[model samples]
Target: MPPHHVAWWRPLFLIALMPIGVLGNLEGDALNAFRQSLIDSNNVLESWDPTLVNPCTWYHVTCNVQNSVVRVDLGKAGLSGTLVPQLGLLSNLQYLELYSNDLSGVIPVELGNLTALASLDLYQNNLNGTIPDSLGQLSNLRFLRLNDNSFTGNIPVSLSTITGLQELYLSRNNFTGQAPDFYNLSKLENL
Candidate 1:
């Protein structure tokens, strides 16, 4: 090929590889957003170096074989802070375990974007405010533990749409009004 053709192909080649190179960084950016929003006194997140291209290499983050974040095991990590909206960017995330922490603030409505989520364990936190109705969007969710928080307001009626929900825990919250009729959650074994 001519020199001019070679130069043209080089740019195309780089562009083709761009998604692969940038995919990891996008997820890393999402996690970094969470890191920045939190106050980590014990430095359990010390390995979460934003400079790294892949957050999968960071502690407490679990990724799938494709290098997509699937689970975050940061429960009881002695951290506190509001959850960031960017967490919804982890499109493939299935399990979000941030329970037993000092975290406060409303659960981000953006979490509704995690359609792949199956387990969301935020129990035993200081988080307050009405649980976002957006959580009803998690159709794949099975185990949702938002118990022991300061959440107020009526539990979202949309939650009744999750037919696959097996375990739902909302005890210890300050919810008022009649709870949603969960007759649609036929798979529910615990509530």
Candidate 2:
């Protein structure tokens, strides 16, 4: 091929790849933001290098064939800190396992933006505050565990609306108000 043809094809190819690159960057940035908010005493997050284009290469992170983030499995990694709102940017995320960590602060309402989420296990953390109503927006969520946290306030009635929810664990929290009936949750087996 002629040099001019090469030049023409180069730009077009890069443009074609731009969307994938951009998606990786977005997911990487979001996970990096979460890393920044934490104190990783166990060096569990040492692989979270921000210089990477995507978080797929990072430890405890999982991605799909499209290079989009799908799961963040950091359970019991001895991490302590607040959850970043940027995590909501993982649009394809299905599972978020941060259980058994010392993570504190309110659950970011932005997490509600994870519409594709199926299992969200934040159990055994130091997280406090009302469960965000935005979580109700996770219509696909099945297993929702917020147990052993310091969260307070009524169980968001909105959560009752998650028709597919199969496991709801809110035990050992300081939550107030009468327990919301789970009878409407046809798939719910544990509460």
Candidate 2 wrong stretches, greater than 4 Å:
1-17
The residue-level lDDT of candidate 2 at 26 comes to 92
Per-residue C-alpha lDDT of model 1 across residues 1-191, encoded as one tens digit per residue: 77876787788888998999687899999999999999999999999999987898999999999999999999999999989999999999999999999999999999999999999999999999998999999999999999999999999998989888999999999999999999777899999
**TM-score quality measure for candidate 2:** 0.91
Flag regions of model 1 displaced more than 4 Å: 1-9
Candidate 1 has a TM-score of 0.93
Could you tally the backbone clashes for each prediction?
0, 0
